[model samples]
Target chain A: MILVLVETDAQGATLVSREALTFARETAARLGDQPVHAAVVAPLEESMATLVMKQLGEQGVAVVHTADDERLTTYAAAAHAAAVVDAVRAEQARMLVAAGTPRGNEVLAHVATRLEVAMAANVVAVDSVEPLVVTRQVLGGSALEEMRLDDAVAVLSVAGHACDPEPAEVPTAPERLGYTPSVTDQDLVARVARTEVTVVDDTAALTGARVVVGAGRGAGGPDGFKDLLELTELLGGALGVSRVVTSLGWRPHHEQVGQTGSRIAPDLYVPCGISGAIQHWAGCQSAKTILAINTDRDAPMVTKAHYAVIGDLHEIVPAINEELRRRK
Target chain B: MANVLVCVKRVPDTAGEVLLSADGLSVDARHVGYTVSPHEECAVELATQVAEATGGRATVLSVGSEDAVEQLRNALAVGCADGVLVEADADLLGPADVAAAVAGVVREREAGGLSYDLVLLGNDAADTGDFQVPVRLAYALGRPVLTGISTCEVQDDRLLARGDGPDGTEVFELPLPAVVAVMEGGVSPRYPSIPGRMKAKRAPVETVALTAARQGSGRVRLKLPPSQPSSVEILGEGPEAAPAVVDLLTRIGVVGR
Candidate 1:
């Protein structure tokens, strides 16, 4: 049996979780029809739970194990790890899969440490289950490493955009199990003190945006983003900045795109005045199409982009925005 | 006063193009220079600030080849007081081995009546991209651990850490004698000055051998990702390219023609 940890967002199961489910489904099929189970650590809110269950069922999960408790509402790594470990034991799962998101990776790390098992993270491909051959992203997605997990339970986290989420041809009704693992005072030692949610406008989130207009140090100053924002609005996308921009206090850190900030796989990414550092490239490398607008023709972003426009973005962005408006 | 231990890794500077070896077993470092990983640089900076504020000593540690002493000296030049080199083949050690070696150092120091109040490490190394050592070390030491922390403050006997979460910033309060895995961009690392470099060149880096058993994860091979074919087409220069950009956007379905 294979157990997958499914994490949900405000609306329902997130894209990364769905990706994990998809990965688990395919891996199970590859392993001669092994059963795939999903373990969710959440509050079990009626409607939310229903939505999650339906999604997991559609994804062909044989069983859905939910560790629903008041303390589980917020992320407590120890508590969540305990729940996953319990679920793994309950199902006698030989493989545990999770999304490579921050929470997914962190919680699974705790599980690995607690169980004293080996884990491979950011796995992009699974070769075989017998010896557990897998390919994982290393050096911040610059290279790939093939690894084999020799442990009894091969714990791994699939990289983002590794697989697409698809529903089963014939969906099955999954058996739902409510699991509550025993927790100790030591488990609560590193609990969340509080969470401050910064609500951005609906279209401003980098992950969900289909088009992203990126800015960098060449953006000059805070005022420089005005045209970029206009371009983003014109393109029906979000505004993303580089690490330097955020570090300079020109933009909020949340809007920064790099290794430390959001990793976006958008349909189109237009980087303006941004010299693509490897750290920044790690975030936007997954975009379907990249167009660089910069004055320097030899800039890394220019060389890496599919399309390049050589000019000052201050003049060029407004021109494009005006051209787009004129076409409209 | 708190005694902090900051773990740093010497990695190939990833700012330049990273090439793979012909054998595909390791990164081709013939052309690339080495530096402390960015996140670990920030960790050293944070440790320095924390020690300065609390009148404590910041000790930097690394488990790598003999040349890793250069990285330790760099850290000392930045602000660290002392350095320790756990002489080992970094390429042969997995996350578990690294954790065990670090745990051995911690135990040995504690035996010598020097107990660290806070242990700091990069959230993940840039080269290996392994997000394991900090948590594993914490587990080995039986200490609470926090990963991917961007902001941290020391308050009396406790520490406050903040990281980005799905919704917003998630804050964590950990008691003393805890482990923290710091992410980059928390603080800009300072460059080594002339006098600092001179002092660092003279600083003694205690070298020790790993008493812990080596752990292997059965790695098969390291391969470079297929080079993305990018044939950049110039859409013209200046404002005249605006129409071409619009046409391209429409072609990509980002806009309607």
Candidate 2:
């Protein structure tokens, strides 16, 4: 059997989780239709649980397991790993999968350590299930490494944007199992004391936005972002900045996109005045289309972009905004 | 006083172009220079700060070939008091074996009455991209582990860690004898002075051989990703490009024509 750890947001299962489910469904088919189970570490609130189960069933999960408890509302890494290890044992799963998000990788790392098993993280492709051959990105997504799992139980995390989420043609009504694992004080040693939400507009989330307008050091200063913000507003998108901009105190770190910042996979990424470093490109390379606007023609961003405009962003942004306004 | 251990790896400087080896097992390091990964540089700095603030000692450790002593000395030049080299070919050791070696070192030190109050590591190594060693070592030692931490403080009797979440910064508090994988951007790592480098050159480094059984991750080979086809069409120069940019945006459906 194969097990997948499903991560849910406030509404329901996240896109990355669905992507993992989609990958799991295909992997299971490749392994002669091995049974695939989905597990969630949450409180199992009735309505949220129902929605999540329905979604997983639609994704062709054969069984759904929930480690429901009030304390699990906020993630405790050790506790979640304990629950996952128990689920893996109960399902007799040979392979376990999760998204390569921060939480997903962290939780699965705990599981791997607790089980003393091998985990292949940021895996982009799964070649086989028996020997567990997989391809993962390395060197900040600049290169790929093929690895095989030599352990009895293999744990893997699918990289973000590796697979497109597709619903099953014929959905399965999954068997639901509710479990409550015993937690110890040691397990709660690194519990989250508090979480502060900074997002003012839901549509402005860097990762979820459809279009992102990026500013960098070339954007000049804090006042320089005013036109970019206007342009982002006109394009119905979000405003993103590079690390230098944030370091210079022109923008918040939350708006930075890079290896150390948010990784975004938007439909359209318009990077204005941004000279792309490898660290910055690692986050935005997944965009379907990239348009770079910069004065330096030799900038990495301009060379790698699908389209380029060699110009000053300060002058070009307001013009685009004006044109967009006229069209509206 | 607290005793802190910081784990570091020597990785090819990623600032330059990286080329893959012929067998695809590793990067070709003939022309490329090696240095500590960015995150681990911060980890060494943080360990030094914590040890200094708490009136303790900070030690650096590496599981790599003889050349890895260079990285260990780099840490020592910064602020680490001592260095330990677990003699092993880093290429031959997977995360499990690395963790086992570290755990072995920890046990040996503790047996010698040098119990570490805290263990520090980079969030993930730059080359292997393995996020397993710190957690695995923590589990082996039966201690608490926190990864991707940006800010850490040594309080009276506990360690406080803060990291950025999807929402905002998430705070974590753990007792001593904890393990933390620190991320970059938390603290600026300082460059070593001439005197510090000279002192580091004279520092005695303890060398230990790892007898742990090698548990391979079944790595097949390494390969460069297929380069994306680039056919960038320059629209125009200066402000004159605004109309073309708008047209292209319209064509891409980001704006209505």
Candidate 3:
């Protein structure tokens, strides 16, 4: 049995957590339909386990456990680690896996320390059975390093953005169970009063939108395009910024999509003025299609893109905006 | 008073584009120099400010090869009162193992009769780029953990913080003895001069807590990473490239004009 934990804030499971569930389900199927269980933590009143089951069941991993303990209002690294350690012990879980997200990596790492076992980070693929072989990316994705793990229980943090999100298909049988760990004075070290979740109340959202419009230093400092809010809203897509825009403080770091920022894998990724640095490419490489609009026809991002438009965005953008409004 | 602990990583300079040795993922000792990552610099910077404001001591800690000594030295240069090198020389562990290594330090430090009122760390190191250590260390130490912190301070009796959220920033106010991971570039770090750097080497740089990597591989060497990238060339046609450009533009919905 491989125990996987899904990290959800007050609103719902995070993007990377969903990917972890997908990874767990696919890995289980390959091993003659071995068991894969998903554990989630939510406020006692909320049915987070049920929420994960709805999504995980569709992918075949239906068994869901929720740590409804009162101590779990906000994510306490200790509390989460204690629960995972118990889950592994109870299931005699063969392996423990987590997404490479900040929270996932942290919680799993804490559990590994408690269990005194060796763990692998940034693993892309896994091959099981008697001393597992895991492939991990090193040197900024410039090289591949294959490592062998010889331990009773293998703990691995799947690289966040290096590998593609695996197919989410699970086995019919799910063994559902939940247990809480004995809290110590130490475990109560961190306290949470409340959690604030950001809801995309705006029309432009990355999840369901097909078109993604972005701006950068090329957008000319968030001022020239006084009607940008209108353009992106009309496109009915979320807005993203390049590293340069964020570095210059023209946009908040949250809006920057790259290896360090958000990894957006939408249907269409429009790169306006982005030169497509390797750091940025690793984040958007999984997108279905890429549309690059850069005056520099020789830009690296333009070459990797599905379609490249060679011209000044300053000259080209106004024309497009006019056409969009004319169509409306 | 806040007793903050910071874990720093010493990586070869990213901006230097330092040549790396091709074997076994080591940076060349000759050309490359190690320093605290920019993100960790912010962590130390914020800690120093908090100590100045609240009347407390900020300590920096690290775990790596003996090369980590240089990182500890760098941290000292930044105004960290003291430093520790875990001297763990092994392949980077997943977050779990790294946190454990840090916990060993906390336990040893705790024996010295000082418990931390807070812990600080960079959101992530640029090299490994793993944003897990701070939060995981908090978990191992049984402390409240906050990752990717944009803002933080200590109030009368509470710890206040702002961490990165989806659409906006989220504010957190907790009791003392919590953990906060500083977001990158949130604050500018201070520079240590020839005087500070030279003085810090002999300054109480302790190895109080060290988990020497389970004596596995003694091999040490680095391979140089490819330094050259494809250069840019203008396709010339200037505005005359418009015809071919318009077709490509219409394909991506950038034009109908």
Candidate 4:
């Protein structure tokens, strides 16, 4: 059996968890239509849990095992991992899959260690089931690696957006089972104590924005971001800056786009003064269209952009803002 | 007072473009320079701060070929008082194997009456992209683990960790002798001064032969993803190009006409 651990938010199962389900469904089909199961470990209300299970069933899950202990009210890697381990044993799962998010990867790592199995992170594809050949992203998605897993139980996390989530042709009302996780006091020692939401600025918008305007070192100084910010507002998009800008203290780290910062997949990305280095490219490579404005035509960003304008961003950004205003 | 251990990996400085080797087994490091990743840099910085705050000493360790000593010495120059090199071919080992090696060191040090109160590592290796080592090591040592922490400090007797989470910035506290994997951007790594460099050069490094099993990641090879083919259309130059840019934006539906 192939089991996927689904992560849920207040709304329901997250997008990445759906993507992992897609991967799991395809992998199950590849393995001669093995049963695909799902395990959800969240401190969810009864209604919310049912909603999540419904979503999972629509994705072709045959059995949905849920952790029912009230002690798991917060995010703790060890306790969640123990819950997954219980589900894995109950279902006799030979393969475990998860989304390659921070929480997903961390939980799976703990599970793999407890099981003493070899696990891979950020896997993009499974080439062969036997001997377990897989392709995964390495170097923060800057490169790809083809690997083989030598463990009896193959454990891997599918890279984010590797495949789009698709509903099963015939939805199955999955059999639901409540599981009691075997957790210890040590497992709860390092759990999340609290969270502080930044009300002053909503940085989550940048990750979910359909349109993003980027600034690099070419933004000059702190005041240089004014034009870019204006253009961002006019386009109804979020503003993103490069690592250098954040390092220079011209922009906050939350606004930085690179390997160490948020990865964005926008419909359109307008980088006004950014030099598209590979580190920054790692974050924005998923953009559908890129338009670069810079004085250096040979810059990496200009070369890779769908459209390029060789000019000083100080003059070009304001002029573009003016044109946008006229059109509005 | 605390004795902290920070683990760092030496990776190719992936700046503009990354090129693969001829056989595709590893990165083409023939021409590119090497440096510890930004995450590891921040981890080292955090380790130093925690040690200094507690009037203790910070030690650095690396499990790699001999070339990794350069990175260890770099950390020593910054603030680490000692260094250890677990001589091994890192390319041939998986995260489990590395974790076993680190766990062995921790056990051996404890036997020798030198115990590390805290262990630090990068959230993920910039080159290998493995996010399992710290957690695996923590499990091996039967200690608590925290991953993706951006800011951390020792508060009295506990470790306070903060990182960006879905709802907001999540905070955590763990007892001493815990493992923490840090991401970059929360702290600035200090540069090595001349005197610090001289002192680091004279510091004696304890080298140990790796005794862990080589459970490789079953990595067959590496290949660069095909670049997106594009023929950039020039939309004129200077502020005069604004109209053309706006036209293109309208064409792409970013701005409605």
Q: Note the DockQ of each predicted structure.
A: 0.65, 0.60, 0.23, 0.76
Which lDDT tens digits does candidate 4 get at residues A1-328? 9999999887799887998998999989988999899988876888998898899989989998888887788889999999999988777798999998889999999999999998889998998887679999898788999988877678899987678789888788999888788888888998999988853344568877889999998999998888899999999999999999988889878888878787787889999888888889888877889989989999999998988889899999999999999988
**Which CAPRI quality tier does the interface of model 2 achieve?**
medium
Best by DockQ: 4
Candidate 1 per-residue lDDT, tens place, A57-130, comes to 89988899987567777677877888889988888899999999877888888888888888899999998877
RMSD of each: 2.0, 2.2, 5.0, 1.8
lDDT of 3 at A185: 51
Model 1 spans with C-alpha error above 4 angstroms? A198-204, A247-249
- Residue A8's C-alpha lDDT in candidate 4? 87
Candidate 3 scores an iRMS of 5.8
RMSD of 4: 1.8
Which runs of model 4 end up more than 4 angstroms from their true locations? Answer: A198-203
Can you rank all candidates by DockQ, best first? 4, 1, 2, 3
TM-score for predicted model 1 compared with the true structure: 0.96
Please give, for every candidate in the order listed, the TM-score of chain B alone compared with the true chain B: 0.95, 0.96, 0.80, 0.96
The C-alpha TM-scores of every prediction are: 0.96, 0.95, 0.79, 0.96
Clashing pairs in 2: A148-B218, B24-B222
lDDT of each residue in A264-300, candidate 2, tens digit only: 8899999999999877887898899998999999898
Q: How many backbone clashes does candidate 3 have?
A: 13
